[model samples]
Target: MMMNKEQEKLPLPLLFRQEANESLLAFCRESARDLPWRRSVTPYRVWISEIMLQQTRAEVVRRYYDRFLAELPTPRALAEASDDRLAKLWEGLGYYRRASLMKRAACVIVEKHGGELPRDYASLRALPGFGDYTAAAVASFAYGLRAAAVDGNLLRVLARLFRVEENVLSSKTAKTLREIAYRMLPDAKDGTSGGERYLYDGYAAAEWNQAMMELGAQICLPNTQPKCEKCPLSAYCIACAEGCAERLPIRESTLKRKEEARTVLRVTDGERYLLHRRAEKGLLAGLFEFPNKEGTLSEDEAKKAVEEMGFSVKSLRALAPARHVFTHLTWHLSGYEVTVPPIDRAALPEDFFAPTKEELYRDYSIPGAFGAYKP
Candidate 1:
């Protein structure tokens, strides 16, 4: 097909218009990782995997994905899942709000969508926690729709390929990059006229999107270490041609992570440990945590704090200090192991309770941030 002068002048790169897409698809066919999420290929599975992959490494997500699916296999199951069960399944993954939002979305799916993920882009996007990227991913990878699932990997790949010098983190830059990705779709040349037809041979929309993501993840790596020699798109990559692939995708964000000091109390009565349920809102919301206070407290202060909770502290020993980094905050933690005499359950604080070791490990969902202090 011949392009008009106006179309020719568009920012859509020749790489996306010609052989680069084919090269990327072929590379993925030969070299894509045998990820577990790639096996089932259901809307529910795809939705879960994409949500889990957010702000998490694929390797780490693998450990939880299968187990989570085994327990809550469908939208109805997820919507009906108990808070304890949900928290336990999602423990250590961080970003607890994702799990909560997923549950809310599952309820909506069960009630409104007939216990299935919606098949269209706009409907999927309307679901709770379903951002444009996630909605696009489910629409394309699961439903085989012509939606562009442009994530960080694709953003990096496109930025380097087009040698974009603007701050890639900005919304304008990301939107532009996403538009370019949409144009690279197989039937995008004909706009909406082709419907679900694939213009490219032996390549589905799912494969194309996954291939682009895989190339970025495996070859066009972030920082200063992109493996240009192994990149299938290297021949057409403007950044590679200019010897500036490493610096092409600029990110000039000004946000800084706030630091916080915390003192964690691992108060135990020999066999049972004290756990507190966080409030139903805010960070780590509705998850279990060790009784902790703001600011690093000395051993004496920790003992006093525990006693103030109406527990008679029998013995106190200092535990090693630990730190946990969240997306926007860093927790510098000091801890104490306080041994207390067994007390009546009624005497415990409203949101505090002591559970046996087995119960704590099996029933409670302790955040990883309290790992160093958990009994």
Candidate 2:
């Protein structure tokens, strides 16, 4: 295969190749945080943790990981979980689609792979919610397979170590970095065996990818202020040697985040709060949320809107404004608390119902976007 011109210009590192791996592993051995997933490394735990960690901070995931596993301890449990149950379990973790796709993937695992995640990269990648990074992560960490999981952190580490100047977000750069990372694998030697058992030191391959990822997350960092002075690979990093460690792995985001105004309505009876199920497909698909409209509405306007939806707004008052930022949009929300006399349950819309706050917490899966208006 012909190499990209950019990759050719900035050749992969050769000096201290083994030494760098040693440094990373040594540092990780002493300093790797005792994460819940690491404590009990299994294909199921690795898959869940990788999926949760996507676009989310590690600290935030720590609290939810244990709870999720305790509730749905196996693929069969996850496969058979009701949408509301799954959503409730995944509450407060944004990106409801991850939970949904995981449910689908769990069903696939139970049906096709006998309720255990496939140990290979291709089968793992074929499952819903399992992308290249996630698949490689589970394969390497769980199964001890020699697969390279190149995430943003790993990309930063590699780009700095080799002084790569290409945009890290570009597909070509990603492919090149994956190639570099795969070459750096501890098990890498000769021919590719299309199954388990590649060709290197047997035990170290499991730690290689995790060590790289941990180094990036803890020390390599991103932006212009990575902790290079404390980095294990600093001695081998071209970016550090050339005094440009901070400027490496150049990236530029092309898309702008659109701003939107929303009025979240909290229609409640004396005991139960009204909730609406979002459409089956789209953002926050199949999740329950408070009744809401497109633009921020005034107290009178919001109450009028709620009344039009087959309810008599006995009392209406505006609550504090809140903001929720998504990948491509920011929702500047205006919320109102509306109280109504008890209405007949049969009069409500099919997609709308009133669940007590406790019931909402235990049964319905409200998205985090409506956090400010939570009853």
Candidate 3:
């Protein structure tokens, strides 16, 4: 009874999504804690969190989420925030361009929507930094419209269930998953509305989205290590039924990781840590860090770059090699803790100045990538 990969991806019973409810309900009823944004599910909180979660882990998002919510609790506050300050707030979250695009959208809301968040799809999609997925998320969660939202996690979960070997990121797979999700959305009449719709908008937008996402994030995983026995959808999963739980999501071979070398300067005199604010553009923009030159370089090249930046390179002390893997490339960092003898104040730009260790700790936001090289 050999089955090809595509053959293994046959359609399941209509109850596939319905059967997932046990896990979803378990997560919602037993495990789901009240996240800060969960308390209100306003357009503002929904929009911000959805945007923040892009390519960023949820645990990390929790930390930034609260601070960002506090700083900009309402669309008015977000609209009022300066691009420079907003970018700074989003410093370590990476994908800096999203922050800029978000600001542009906020401006639109303030000017055109009167600081009120839009409820429909088209208007929301038109906003900068928001695409189809984000627009659907906001429309459903923020406004309770039953638009299906798809992301990597969703595609992974769906592909495995259907035993789909198609490119998970392909436009076709994405469209299929979105259609399936929308089709399987709990009816409004199932809960308590007495034939009127049972699954409320809240359930569709907030609960369903969270449940599917949490399942993907927590159980139905990417690696060949998913705990099928523990997965709520195990009973209905095509992979599980066929005793091939780990192999259903047929994805193509991964592209090679692009490697880049960065030379980090942990510039410090005896007392102060020399740090620089990256330009309000490019990578690491709006974050504070020791100066670095992109691409792997020899000690001589690093020194030349540092000297060219007007900082005297006194001594280069080696540190443990630290590697950071970004989305498309891996950064192999060879850090040398350099100490520059105090330079004349006149040698630097008026905006750049020396900050002590205390000041750097108190004020500067250094990315974790270069932290090991910190002076």
Best by lDDT: 1
- Model 3 off-target regions past 4 Å? 1-13, 16-27, 191-205, 253-257, 277-280, 294-301
lDDT of 2 by residue, 141-215 (tens): 788777778888888889998899988888888888888887677644322222233112254556777778789
Quality of model 1 by C-alpha lDDT: 0.84
Residue-level lDDT for 9 in candidate 3: 63
Each candidate structure's count of clashing pairs = 0, 0, 6
Of 2 and 3, the candidate ahead on lDDT is 2
| Model 1 misplaced regions, further than 4 Å | 1-10, 188-203
**Model 2 off-target regions past 4 Å?**
1-12, 188-201
Query: What TM-score do all the candidates reach, one by one?
Result: 0.92, 0.90, 0.83
Q: What tens digits encode model 3's per-residue C-alpha lDDT throughout 260-357?
A: 88777666777776667777777666666777778766778777777787777888766677898765778888766676887555566754656777
Instruction: Write the number of the candidate with greater TM-score, choosing between 1 and 2.
Output: 1
Worst 10 residues of 3 by lDDT: 191-200
